[model samples]
Target: MTVTAESALAGVQRIIATYAQNIDAGNTDVVADLFTEDGVAEIEGQDTFEGRETIRKVYGQFSPQTPQLHLVGNTVLTSEPGEEVTATSNLVFFARGEEGWGIQLVGTYEDTAVLVDGEWKFRRRVTKFL
Candidate 1:
């Protein structure tokens, strides 16, 4: 199937939204599944995670009880019909602290998404905290 500009944006957006939901829900396994076999994730202040297994292992450190909400916005996508798509989005992370739920992290996600076997998966994602 050809990946048109519209399809690429929509598919990548879906992946972004799904990622936020899964991470907030502490379903890191599901989040890991959203990436390609050799996907890489680089988060600020953390070691870069390469491959799904490593990604899952690292993300497993996050406890479900912590309760985090990842708010993603302002996504921009650039792509060709049959090539990888590059996307960027702003992120606001709200987490439950000792006092209450509040914004704890602000960042931007730079991602490379590829269509693999008719599915859009993350090839590489970099999170830059601001």
Candidate 2:
């Protein structure tokens, strides 16, 4: 890959990695921070969240009793080049309990990211049940 393509991939990967880390670590604010100010998120056939605040609320449902870990598979990524990128990837949702981790939801996320201020921010994230 060319340097530019590599850089773009790095930016996208960073965004995905940070999201997983913050969500798994229960950093709610950080989770919200990963998204754009006007970002949107749709949860697998569930209702669609319209903004950062809305997404925060949806994420809030993952309480201490049910911590979540979202695993994104690279093989499912569909990213594009340039300052804008729209991609979709499969996500394996995990929940923690006394017995240990359990797979809860298996779905896909369609993400629209923009290179804003030299950084990538997700403008929209739509999920579909598989």
For residues 1-130, write the lDDT of model 1, one tens digit per residue: 6677888888889999999999889888999999999999998798789999989988888747777799999998854546589999999999897999999889999999988888899999999999
Give the C-alpha miss distance for residue 7 in model 2, angstroms.
Answer: 1.7
Worst 10 residues of 1 by lDDT: 75-84
Task: List candidate 2 stretches off by more than 4 Å.
Answer: 1-3, 75-79
Q: Which digits, one per residue and each the tens of the lDDT, describe model 2 over residues 82-128? A: 78777777789888888999998788778887787788888887778
**Using Cα atoms with residue i matched to residue i, what is each candidate's TM-score against the true structure?**
0.92, 0.82
Pairs in steric clash, model 1: none
Ten residues in sequence with the least summed lDDT for candidate 2: 1-10
Q: Report the alpha-carbon TM-score of model 2 versus the true structure.
A: 0.82
Q: List lDDT for all candidates, in order.
A: 0.89, 0.76
- Model 2, position 118: C-alpha lDDT score: 80
* Model 1 clash tally, residue pairs: 0
Q: Roughly what TM-score does model 1 have, to 2 decimal places?
A: 0.92
RMSD of each: 1.4, 2.7
lDDT of 2 at 84: 71
